[model samples]
Structure formats: C-alpha cells, structure tokens
Target: MDMRALRYFVEVVRQNGFRRASATLHVTQPAISRAIGQLEEEFELNFLVREPRGVCLTPEGDVLYRRASLILQQADSLASELRDLRSMVSGTLRVGLPPMTGSTFFGDVITEFRRQYPGVQLQIIEYGSNQFAGALSDGHVEIAAAMLPIEGEGFLTQTFARERLALLCSRDHRLAARKKVTLRELSDETFVAFTSDFKVNNLIDRLCNQEGFEPSVSGRSSHLDLLVSMVTSGMGVALLPVTVCRGIRSSRLRVVTVIDPVISFDQALVRHRDTYLSRSARAWIEIASEVLGFHVDPVFVA
Candidate 1:
C-alpha cells in the first residue's frame, strides 16, 4: 500500500473524521475518501464504518494502525540515514548543555561521537537547565542534557542516568568528616547555592522546606565546579551531584551524603516534542545511551 494512503488512514483515525483529517492534511475530503477507498479495495476488506458523527475503524483497521505507525517511524529514520550518507558530508549541530554536567560527565560521549562523525561540528552552548529548556522549546538547540523532574510541556525526555546529590564542605568545617548528615543537622548552615537558573536550586529549596527551614543563600553561581570550590574555600557548604564531586580531587574538601530523605535527580536527553531531529542528532543520542545506559527509546528518530 502507499505510505501516503497509510498516513491518511492514520490521520483520519486520529482526528476521528475524514473531513477533519482532510483539513489537517491540507487535502480535500474527496482526495482522502478516494485514498481510503483505494486502501480498502487493495486489502479486500471494509476497514472503516461510516456513521453520522464520523468514521470508526474496524478490528483490521486497528491492527494496521499500530503497525503503520511503526513503519512510518522506521521509514523516516531510514530516509534521514540515507540523506546523511549522500549530501551531508559535513554538518554542524548546536546543542544546549547545563553548566553542571557540561564539563565533567559528558567527556567520553563527546569524544566517541567525534571519533565516529569526524566531519560534524558540535557547537555547545552552556546555560543552566531552567534557561536551556526555554531555548530548546524555541528551536535554539537540537537537544539538551536536562535534569529531571522537569516542570513544563512541549518536551520529550529519555532518562539516561541517576545520581545522588552530595553535600560538599571545607575539610576544616566541624561536620566535614562525617559519613552522612541529616538535613536537620545543617539547618543553620549558610549555603552556596546554584541560582534559580539551575533546577538544583529549586530542588534544594523544596527539600529544605520539607525539613522545616529555608536554607539561607550565602552565594550563588551557575558553574558546578565554582560552587564546589566555594565550599572548599570555606565560604559556605553546597549540594552537588556525586559524579561531579568525584571528578574533582581536592584534599581540602569533603564529600558527604545527605540523609533524612536522600536527595537525587535523574539526567535525561531532552528535546522539543514536535522537532525534526537530524541524523547527526540521532547518532549523538545513540552514542550517549551507550555511555550512560544500555539503551534509549529507539523511536526517537521520528
């Protein structure tokens, strides 16, 4: 059967009327009806029932609907892959990155992607997660590494990793050597927090509120390393991802776990829901899944 006819059938089922589907597909009702008639004739079955309200699909039509959706997704990915092989000898991808994981966690993924697609240029823009989400929705970047539980719409996300948020303090601080500390223990401590631009600041505030006190913000910065360094210099303590703390080896700093409802957040590959992803973008996400997880959603290419 023709892919265009299958698409018309799917859209008709989704919109629940041939007329509505015609409007959505920017075709006349006669054209849609003719396509559906051709499909039914080719398959030798009545796949739809007409009523006063609209059209309803038969059992056979439902089966075709599910399979056709996957086939269309596969077709798009294959088409993109072929285009990458033909005309895109070289291409540039603009990516949004949060400052926290931008420097430390993505080294291997970026290096491997570069090794495989040497001709593709990567333009990395560093922003806090909260700010980057807006850029992503506005078509500013192809994809982003975002911290979850993101609060918004018009985004599709696949979780790649989860890490606990650890408390970092100067070695000379009174609680530095402790293996773990409860939230109440640090109730009065001044905090060097990520600004509102970073989602972690919101997480910190929410958790602290649950613990019955608002953390007094002593300093603010978007850079993770800079925030951790501030803690090491005895300005104030900070909460950071454990993976980030592991990347920095400093004898003057201590990394301790937070208890009384342990704090953690997921890291995900995020993009606009309706965006058209390129071959290079899809390839980068696949490589990142290899680095961070066993697999990601394969249908993301569509």
Candidate 2:
C-alpha cells in the first residue's frame, strides 16, 4: 500500500535477506521488518516465509513483487519526467556502457557531451551486456551502449557502429601470419573468451556452432585488456572487436579478421521505448550519432 513499504519489500527480495537490504537502503532492519509486516497486515495475507538464511516469498508476495517492481520503475520515471520540465538541460543523466566501449570512439562522444551540457551530472556506468540491460529496463539508466539485438521488448535502439571481430593470437601461433582466418581454422586452438554475462558469448557460441566445433576455452575474463594479455602470454587466442584491436601495441599479438561467415560485432545505443527523454539524454544520443557517423532512424528492435 505504501511506496516505501513496497520498495523495502523489493529490496529484501533482491538481496534475499533483511540485513543486506537494510544496509543497502541505509535503514534499520527493524524498519524494513516493520514495513514488510505492515504490508502483510494491510493485505491480510502472509507475504514472506522466514528462514534461517534469509526469507522466501509466499505466492501472494511473488505476485505483488512482480507488480510492485513495475510500479516502482514507473514511479522513478515519473519523477525524472517531472524534472525534465525545467528550462535548463540540467539533471543527472545516467548512461551504461560495456567495459570494452572505451577502446572505440565513445570516449570522444562522452567528452563532447560534457562540453555541451556542463550543467548536467553525467554518471557513466561500465557493465557487461546483461547487467546494463537490466539497469536500463529497470529505469536505473536512461541510455546504454550494447551489442545489437538486445533481447526482450519495450526497448529501442539507434545504430552506433558495425565491425568484424578480429582474431588476436600470439605471434608464435601458426595462424598469426594470415590477414584473415575462419572460425573453422581456429577450432583446434585454445580460446580466451569473455565471461558468460556478456552477449558477445552468444555470438561466439553461434559462430562456433556453425563451424561444427565448440571453442576450447583456456580462460575467461570480463576485462578486454586481460583477455588481450592472456593471448599475448600464449594462454589462448581471443576474438576481439577490430576497433579495440587497433589500440593494442604489442608486437607479439597479431590481429586477423575472421571470414567464411565473418563474426560481426554491431553496437547500438539503447533506451526504453516509453521513457521520457530528458534534454540531457537527447543531447547525449545526438552526440553519439554524430561521433559514430550514423544518422539512421532508431531501430525498433530490442
């Protein structure tokens, strides 16, 4: 019934405990407990089943949790939308980016955005594809840059850039001398892949499947530089964006393009379809388009 109670309930469910949720919300555990107890009493239903480790949600609580999450998301957007009524293009603009995005032209885009909208507080978050998609969908961030074909609905995308994934191998590898290589050729070699949370893994899996072999992964990492380092140390070969590969100055590394079904890495700036675009958000998108040189219409895909 109460917004604060609902938020407390949601955080408890998210953190799977009372103490952690209280810590996260900067409130006392008794406050959260009282809030949840009040919600249950108000609805005349048992919402949670207490456990030693944490707590489990009753069926009623599960249903309320789903609905309350959406309600809170909308409430957050409503406040932001109200703030957008101000004359100045000033407010907090939160944008999510993949960790590897900086190796591309996005740094320049951020610089230009700050130059134009100095009054706006720009909060940049670096998260992998899955994490940021959740952040964007939950209204925690206004816009995000991610690999194209973002899953789920209620989101729209504007194209950023498209480039092939280049193979990075140590100079001692037999394929290092080639300008281009196919996925089939690298089947026998050890692979260094991004962590499972990245959507890039989906592309890698599909390409590897089409090539009739699974990648023999030697290591996994979330950092691009670490992956490149692993390849440099001869730990394994890696597939990286060509834009990122351009910045690698190691002589021991060879950047070769993949072909015979080239693995394309297409990136786009994504935002919720119905979200109110603040002036700051709009300016960031426009600057990204200008920097990336893509003037196309917003792609209505997920």
- Name the best candidate (by TM-score): 2
Model 1 Cα lDDT, one tens digit per residue, 1-302: 89999888877876689889888789998998899899999999888898889888899998887777656655654565566778653477777878887766678888988999898898787778887665665455679988887668877888888878888899999999899999888889999988788988888889899899999888998766678778988899988888888887889999989898798888888886766688789888888888776477765556
- Model 1 sits at a Cα RMSD from the real structure of 12.7
- lDDT (C-alpha, whole model) for all candidates: 0.81, 0.85
Clashing pairs in 1: none
Name the weakest run of 10 consecutive residues (lDDT summed) in model 2. 293-302
TM-score of predicted model 1?
Answer: 0.71
What candidate 2 gets wrong by more than 4 Å, as runs, is 8-58, 296-302
TM-score of each: 0.71, 0.85
Model 2 residue 9 CA deviation in Å:
4.3
